[model samples]
Target: MSNLIPTGRTDIEWRNESTQKPPKAAVYPAEANADKILKAAYEHTATVWTGDFHNAKQVLAAMKKRVKRPSEKKRAGGGDAVAERSRNIQTAFHAHRMKQAQQSRILNMLAVEIGAGFTLDIPRAPDVKAALADVYGKPNDAPFLLPLNQLLGFIGAHEWHKKGVEIPALGGRIHVPFGVFSPLRGEYLDLIAAALAGSKFQTAFDIGTGSGIIAALLAKHGVPKITATDTNPRAVACACANFCRLDLDNIVIEKTDLFPAGCADLIVCNPPWLPAKPSSAVEAALYDPESRMLEGFLNGAAAHLNDGGEVWLVMSDLAEHLHLREQDFLPQCFQTASLEIAEVLQTRPKHAKAADENDPLAFARGREVTSLYRLKKAV
Candidate 1:
């Protein structure tokens, strides 16, 4: 058992004996312990959790089953009480985090089995050791170990990279690279296309441009100039790659948290629809938790809009229908931000999850609604 403590924040560098490739490893947090590391490895491997990788994944998914279990049991039946339900949800969230943290710790404690080749003893190790090596910039013979949680994260990210979703709305489909968000919802894309049909803006800014889909759409619609900005390095890389592929290299992709230091005739944002704590880094698309992105866009939008410029706010009232958020509070947020609603375009979600009767929030889905609001900064 070799314990290598990182000196500081600097990455750990290693050389592969066979492939002569160099790779850098991330430093683990100081407080990680052996038990936490072991738990993470067990979670990743199907043997301890089960023997099948898919089964292990299903077990992990079971953690979220309660989040949508309310609709299955009739209102007056032997279902959990409201208070119990809330507590269960809270527990689910905490357990999810605990599992993730343990996984990260395990990856940090991982030790490499070095010989003529390399292998990892971590539980349920991914079959894509070659792919992982490529990403880590190492050869198959490089002897290195990463935290169990981090290794799982890398493998999950690799899968997502391999099976990229294509957006039909954007003529040139955007690919989701590792650690970048994939556009999983299609209803919102339809809403955006319809909303942009009658609008005329030569220059536009796409705030929080995850995969740069909006920017690509603007460019496709004959908009000569579009600026796409995101704070995440993964998002920036994904967006740039999509733009380059579409030959919209003119669409500048910036690494800004929000708006750039200039104004635009049109600014558009599709902030996460729900305001709740995210279960993981990947859940940013589903939950903003703090409404930080939504608020930031609204508060800074007025300053970035040109004369008669419009800020397109695409969102859903699903949270409101589920009682998680107040429907009327959205307009109030606009008012507080000093903006007025110019127009509202509504659409229904096409995802099967929306109409899933078994979902805990299905009551809302039965009558759920989503909309796109065009707002203008008050003069």
Candidate 2:
């Protein structure tokens, strides 16, 4: 953790729940240049303290620019390093992930201390009490330290929650809370909307229902009763709120791992598509860590489903393109789970990243297809 001290306070004190002793503090001067700050951050892992909030942001930007800037040798290579790595898609993907992890570690070294009531003592810092409360709930008397990047994320999340994302399929907005996954990509939702159109499904289960988008959509399409479950408390709260906002009274949100207690006519899950470990809570929406969630959903779907019920697994084929999973993996999982694919509905991504040729993974993103895999118990 970064040792962020308030200005004009010389005495240093650290508080924590851990039994281990705190490390010796490394504090940078307020007027330190970005190059000096970057050197300390990258080498000694020093915590930065700035009385001027704007200067801190500028230093962070400069640090990022310097860290990401390619070396002179790479510049002389005629083509960028990413282009060279693109020859092997898997290598490129892993390298990209490594770079991202490295960047996060270095950037997170820039820290700030938030006092009780979520007040920032730094000059030029905007009032973030509301945003802090939204993300961290009620504040305690003790002050806390957080990365400047994460503080920015909380502010952005509050703005997103204030102005919800519009879902064309539901003709309503779904406000996503901090730490909850927002439904920014509409292609997967479109598959659900199309699948549920004019459907007579009575009861449904939305597994891993982040923000309750799937379950809400199910209710909007006339499903009488729906049970949505998520292991994340934040997601459970966010989903419940969204359900109320959409005026969908039939959906019940629960803080369970995946499936709720009884059988249902339909079960839907959009698990994290990547088969990699997530670095943060929010990244859980993208990385599944060895496909645990996916395998769990497939293995348990049959037991919690009624006769003739269908399990709609929404996923993208980007994993295969990146060599993260084999083409036959899903089929084999379904077979092992004694489930058969009734229908596979596919939709190509319409997101900007899919169309951006400059993206390192453009080859994979271009061919990526989001699919609604309609599966059922095999006799």
Candidate 3:
């Protein structure tokens, strides 16, 4: 939603309802009234304000103000709610700009494929740029020509990811990159963590570690040595950063197709089970064309696993529910890879999307079963 509110184009207006027209009070270059405007927003007051991207300093200042509360507890409690409301305001106020930003990203990536330079840099005000610059030790150079959509996405992630995601399963919060693929980190990550709870491996491999979440979990569970790999450079950089931030020096992240050279006592892969083409980099972790990643792990795993070691395959059966893949597809691949399943730990998805009747694949998502299949070399 960072792209939701692009600088300039004062045409953006926020009301309790989307259909509401721009108010006359919303005039560009208007005086900065951060206190009043923020007070009104907190009171659920509807006052449209229009300011060209040039005057975004005034606009963003008003938006960032704390929605004042009377009691100290209420003021301090649920800061997340306040942040959520701010995001809602941003999302609802400039929905069209976000779409435009996304379209720009898609076009940019496609253009880059055919030898186009990334020439688009979303214009940011001094305050906005400074806010982004605040997060350093990672990078603090002048802004480069990042794609409008992706840069905005990064900005949004910088703001929220700074808060970090609490994973009760791991007894910690995982800070992820702006646009990196984050496995919902609950059911799947926790399931795999739980399945390997009592086990202690001298060395472990986390295949396609997007955010290094799984590898970190394995490390926390007493894995002495862990090597993680990812095909995407962004994921590689992201996982590495998260590892440093989380003090998980024990986990080594590398940029590789699936697995690095040599072998380990445990090999873990959480492939995109569905067989389809990914529309974006973000979707790559969800859609595995012809199940290439999945198959790659199954086929290459045995060569890297130590004797009696197992490959942990974490995935969901939503593909079968949607008729995109057969129920026996995974097992068949295992057998084809000359691997035998040692144990199957399954859990039903409890996400809100599963209960949504409007989801096209509600029937499938509702009944989806995620499993961690422990596979070992067949005799």
Candidate 4:
């Protein structure tokens, strides 16, 4: 793989294992005594929270009082491995608390119970009908869950006078329906915004336009015409709703795998960065194992792009640190896709992973760089 491409020239770099000190905080995975954890959790009361979602609400409520707000705590001064073990326990406890919180939330939102099969007890509403139809496709009034989180978001958006959550980068909030991925929370949105700010676009297409954030930004940037697409039906509906909420109906959204139709002067894509299978639907926006979506975009870009037009592919090398991707994998992608790296616009991430020293992958995460690859069809 090293012979396939030289990495010395690129803006990205692999982990320097030698320079990194053995991480100060050590965690004993097995040393975590379940009995001790459970006793602490129940406050010596009955073990209402042992290890399942059945008592999730109770466990999470108890955890909230104990877990510190994900902090390092004034450096915690010096401590031996035991002290480090304590910190690790704290971190793990924090993670457990969070998992419980999520489980509780999901359990509470299971409006429709599943017993025998796919039966759902859906709440009837005007928008609910559309949401149900959007997810179920020609309702049988059968028992099926319609990605209620997004439906709830849609419902919430309608009830609230505001359009959506505010994005300082987009200069406003984008109403992200329950499932649609929010771009404002991460650096990619800001990086994409910065890259597009100095460039002029006559026509553009936003691939995988979750929540239509990029498409909306393009329209706001004064691009005359724009087209956006997503394979997820919920995302298609969500993006459309957000476009309407932002009053940018000019951006046409379609349900497609990667590309829509003819070429445009500029194309933008923000693929799932991780090369791992997502655990659930909402996680799809973040995890794309095997780089399926990323590869698809690169492989198909040459066909959809107009001559001299560039496809701005947003990427990050953090996956490299997590041992998820090979260092040369990205360059090999450009070569395989018959695309040339015209320019690499990169920024060291300000995200939590970069600042976290206690993280197991801190060495890699600390040096992670997020970049927008300005790629073009090879002539």
Error of 3 at 188 (Å): 1.3
Give candidate 3 regions above 4 Å deviation.
1-126, 130-152
The digit string of per-residue lDDT tens for model 1 on 221-256 reads 877888999987768877887787778866998898
Which is the leading candidate under lDDT?
2
Regions of candidate 1 where Cα sits further than 4 Å from its true position: 1-160
RMSD of each: 8.4, 3.6, 12.4, 14.4
lDDT of 2 at 32: 75
lDDT of 4 by residue, 83-129 (tens): 45344443543344355444333322212221123233323323354
Residue pairs that clash (backbone atoms under 3 angstroms), model 4: 118-143, 119-143, 120-143, 150-178, 165-173, 166-173, 275-289, 276-289
Candidate lDDT values, in order: 0.63, 0.81, 0.62, 0.61
TM of each candidate vs. truth: 0.69, 0.90, 0.65, 0.64
Of candidates 3 and 1, the better by TM-score: 1
Question: Cα deviation in Å at residue 95, candidate 2?
Answer: 1.4
Candidate 4 stretches with Cα past 4 Å from truth are 1-58, 63-163, 358-361
TM-score winner between candidates 1 and 2: 2
Candidate 2 at residue 85, lDDT? 55
- Comparing 2 and 4 on TM-score, the stronger one: 2
